[model samples]
Target: MGLLTIVTAAAVAGAGYVRARDAIVQRAQDNAVIETTNRVEQLYPLPARVFDHAALERIAGRVSGREGSAIAYGDGISAGGMDPSVITGELRSLVSSGRVGWQRVSYAGAVWLVVGMQLRITADGSSRSSGVEVYVLRPFTSEIEVVNELARNAWLIGSAVLILALGLAFLAARGVLRPVRELQLAAWQLGQGDLTARVPVRGRDELASVASTFNSTASSLEHHVGELTRMEADARRFVADVSHELRTPLAAMTAVTDVLDAETASLPGVAGQAARLVNRETLNLTRLVNDLIEVTRFDSGTAALALDDVDVAEVVRTCLRMRGFTEVSASLPDGVRARLDPRRLDVIVANLVGNALRHGAPPVSLTLSVAGSVAGSSLEILVADSGPGLPESVLPHVFARFYKADSARGRSEGSGLGLAIAWENARLHGGTLTAANRPGGGALFTLRMPLGGDA
Candidate 1:
């Protein structure tokens, strides 16, 4: 805006100055030409043919009565208050050839418009040069003053226009930019989880329209989010209540199954088979119930770290031994101690290695190593197998609860929540669990736990 104003002002001022200057110059030339022609006509035939000093002075006085003075000279006679040098050579040449001519020249530290004309002699029906000439020297001082005044006015007006334009541009920018800045800050707050963030709308301009639309969208988002949060809380409460209600009966059933298991070998064919299957199913039911309760605890945010400084190698070995994962290969580095929940670490290891042993072929391998320096150190546990790798379609959902890669395997021996629970535990420790395919073959599960107290 400012640039456009400057260019427009400069062009207008330049054009105004040019026109004023041209008009003044044109007026000065016109006046000089008219005065010289009229004086020559009045002194026609060159009074007395050849002039003495007094007669020449009379001709000078007649020609020079206007705002400027003049000179009249013919043969060896000349008279005037102004210098003859004010008439240029070019003007003198044209006039000496019996023509009236004019020119502008610099003279005596100022500009002069000079007009010269030679007297013509009339004889019979023809005319010829008489050698008597009159030259008028009109000063341009007043015209210069007029031009200077116009130029000064042009500068003053152009500057005023530019300043006014700048003031208007500043106001327009403030009106637009303040709203835009508010919108930006509100958007940032919304992204940072402030659902109540809103911008103030003013006027009925385009900026106001945009702000209104953003407020409408944010309000809808807040409404939907409120509904979802309430529903989620209710679901968690339902699961927690149901799991608690079933625990008592499940404990009683476990006691009955244990007694049945001991007497299974002493019973007859069908009863013996029935008792064994009942015992096995009761144990599986107990495991599933426990798993569901653990998931509820995670969802309710009641899960916490019970940190103990312990040897990581011993934890892994004990988890493997307790789970009868004896055939699995292990690379437990010596004396890698960390402040961690030892029970949670054991659960993480058991889930990953157990999944590998069940889903993959031996030689399954568990590798433990510390990554990064001591202050920022992290413990990484890698469990890999030599069977088929995870399907590409299943990799993205590998840690999702109850997500089975093969649909028919939904009722498989292992509960589907193992990886999900493991992931939750890793997150609770401020770490991560990831699954991938080994470069060589089969599936890989990696667990990383940060070492510092901040974890």
Candidate 2:
């Protein structure tokens, strides 16, 4: 708006200045013609009298006032007030043709109007030229000053109009943007988790409509978020309750399965096979139930660490030995100990090694290393296997519960909760467990734990 006002004001001022200057020049030209006509009338009777150079000088003195004058005849020139040479030949030619000749020209750095006219007299009962011509040089200084003053006024008025227009535009912009600013602040609050944030509605404009829409969207979002939270909570509660209820019956089934395992050899072939199958399925059910209970503990925030000061390398070796992962090689260094949760550390190691044995090829390795001082040391356990690395698609969801990479493979032998449980245990101990593809064609699991567990 300001720019448009500026351009408009400039154009108007420029055109007004031009018109005013032209009118002033025209008025000056009209005045100059009238003065020349009056001077020529006064000179009409001079050529009728007998005149000498001295007489012509007197006539020239009467004709020329504060401006300038020149009277030209054969072998004689009378000039005063200004130089007579300023009258050029073009003006003289027009005068010889019996017409008033006038031209505006610059002389001595000032504008002057040179007017020339021929004087005539009645001789031998016929009008004849007297050979004497009158020329007048009138300066246009006063008229130029008037034009300049008009230009100054035009520009001043243009500046005032521009200022007033800019002020009005600023007020209008403020009125439009106030509601936009309110909506911006409200959006920021909503993004920061303040679901109740809202914009105050003002007039019935586009900005007001936008604010109203934002308020409606925010309200709907808050409602949906609340519903999702309750649903998630309800789902967790159901799992916890079901797992809790199944534990009692699962204990009884495990005891019965142990007896059937002892009597399997004495039964017939089909009955013995059936007994073994029942025992195997019972064990699988028990594991699934226990895993669910553990998941519930994690969901309920009941998982905790039992910190103990023990040699990390011995813990790794013991975990491998208990899990019967004898085919796996170990790079455990002795004489290194720290405050840790040995139990959760064993579980983490067991899960990693068990997963490596079940899913990967031979030449598996487990390495334990310790760093920092005893008070603030950290431990890293790297378990790698010589097998095809995890696919890029499967790496991210490796620890997700019951997530199978190949859906058509049906259910895997072990519950899919192993890696998830391992990850939870690591997180519970203020550590991290990560899986990745080894650079040299294998899968690697890295576990990092602060030696001084968060006690």
Please report the candidate that would top TM-score against the real structure.
1
Which candidate number maximizes lDDT?
A: 1
Model 1: CA > 4 A from native: 45-102, 118-131, 373-375
Candidate 1 residue lDDT tens string, 272-303 = 99999989888888888888899999988899
Which residue runs does candidate 2 get wrong by more than 4 Å? Answer: 45-52, 55-59, 66-76, 85-113, 120-130, 177-197, 255-279, 296-310, 336-340, 370-378, 408-412, 424-432, 449-455
Clashing pairs in 1: none
Per-residue lDDT over 125-217 for candidate 2, one digit per residue giving the tens place of the 0 to 100 score: 788777777777788889888988998898898788778878888898788878888899999999999999999989898888898999999
User: Backbone collision count in every prediction?
Assistant: 0, 0
